[model samples]
Each structure stands twice: as structure tokens, then as C-alpha cells.
Target: MSQIPLEHILLLSAVLFCLGLLAVITKRHAVVVLMGVELIFNAANLNLVAFSRYDPSLLQGQLFSLFVIVVAAAEAAVALAIVLRVYQHFKTANLNEIATIDK
Candidate 1:
């Protein structure tokens, strides 16, 4: 069976991670930041699965990826709940605007 090169997968993962980092660093919206966090999680998952495919002796990588996915889902739910509350209370979802402690 044909297989993808490890380098290609790693490169894609790196690009995804960089884009996610950029979004997390530059975006001011809470939702966008959450999405960026999800992207990073996905990139890590991709790497884990790719490595697992290369070495079939153990399925630890795939299992860990599954765990990460589960955690990411739970995180999304809680994070969205918090974001919604912040928006309702502050009248805006902008992280920069809501970051003020004096309000």
C-alpha cells in the first residue's frame, strides 16, 4: 500500500499551527480566538495520527488523538458558554473590550 510521507504531514501540521497561532495572537473576538485554539488542536491531532500510521506496533498516537478530540469538544462547549455570557453581560464579544478590569 502507498503511504504519505511523514515530512508532508509534518509540514501541513506546522502550517496549520502557525495559522492558528496567528489567529490567537491577532484576533480580538472571543469566538475567533476559540476557533484558533481548535485549529491548533486539530494540527496536533493530525501529527499524532500521521505518526501512528508510520508505526503500527502501537496505537498510542491514535488513542491520544481521540482523547484530544474529546477534550477539545468539551473545551469548545465550555468556552462557548463563557463567551456567550461575556457577550450578554458586556454587550460585545471583543476580547480587547472585555479585558478591562475596571469596568
Candidate 2:
């Protein structure tokens, strides 16, 4: 049985990153945008893990990925808190409807 190539993982991560970019650009819902951000973060993490698996000399990629995961978790928490506050103030989570405070 043949093992899968690391290039395949990189390609998949690229596709996911593109899809997340599209979602962030096209979606108007706050939660959907958040999901897109998470997807992008995961794609980057996937790339890090893939590189770590393929390169024996670098354990740093995997360690960096762990740090990214932790940061992503904190980002999610803060983002969700902000989203909830926006929902409470606006009564909806649609990004299009949420006006800038200064505007």
C-alpha cells in the first residue's frame, strides 16, 4: 500500500483556504463570517501539520500549529462575545445591517 503524498495535503489546505476566503467575501451573516475565519485558521493549521509530518528536521511547525490553535480558541471566544453583544444591540446578526458606531 502506498502512502499519500504531502503535496495532496497542501493542495487540500489551499482549496479550503480559498473556500474560506470566498465565504468571508460573499457571506453577510456574522456567524458565517466567523466560520470562514475558523476555516482559514484550520487550513493554516493543516499546512503546518503537513509540513511537520513531511520534514523530520522541523518540529517547530507542529509546535507553532499548537500555538495557533490556542490563539484561534481565544479569538473565537472574543469574537463570539462581540457577536453576542452586536446581536443584543441590533437584534440580528447580519453584517450588512450592523452600522459602524461612528457612522
Candidate 3:
């Protein structure tokens, strides 16, 4: 099987990472930011899997990525729960509004 160049995979991952960072930075909605965080996690997973393809001996990279996926799932669950509670309390999911409410 012809494999894609590592550089290409890395570049794709970098682009995804950057886009996620931008969303996290520019978005005010809690849910949107959470989605951005997911994107970043996915980018990391992509890198891990890509590297593991090259080194198939132990598949440690794939194993690590699996752990990361589990952690990300847990984080997303907790974060959405918090967002739900915050929306109930503040009537808005905007981070700026939530911050102002705490003061």
C-alpha cells in the first residue's frame, strides 16, 4: 500500500490545530469553544495514528492515541454538563456573559 507522506499528515494536523486554536480564541460561546477543543484533540489523534503507521512494531502511538480519545470523551462530557448548568443559571452560553455573572 502506498502511504501518504508524513509531512502531508503533519501539515494537515497543524492546520487543524491552528483552526481549533482560532475557534477557541475567537468564539465566545461555551459550546463552540468545546467543539474547538475537540478539534485540537482530533488533530493530536491524527498525528499519533499517522506516526504509528510508520512504526508498526509496538503500536505505542496508537495506544496513546486511544487513551487520548478516552480522555477527550470524558472531558467533553464534563464540559457539556457544566455548560448546561451555566446556561440554566445565566440563560446564556456565552463565556463573556458567564464571566460577568460570576462577579
Error of 1 at 78 (Å): 0.1
Go through the candidates in order and give each one's C-alpha lDDT.
Answer: 0.95, 0.91, 0.95
Prediction RMSDs, each to the true structure: 1.1, 1.7, 0.9
Q: Which runs of model 3 end up more than 4 angstroms from their true locations? A: none
Better model by lDDT: candidate 2 vs candidate 3: 3
On a 0 to 1 TM-score scale, where does candidate 2 land against the true structure? 0.91
Per-residue accuracy of model 2 over 1-103 as CA lDDT, tens digit each:
8757988999999999999999999999998998999999999999998888878898988999999999999999999999999899888898877865427
Give the better candidate number (2 or 3) by TM-score.
3
Output candidate 3 Cα RMSD. Answer: 0.9
TM-score to true structure, per model: 0.95, 0.91, 0.96
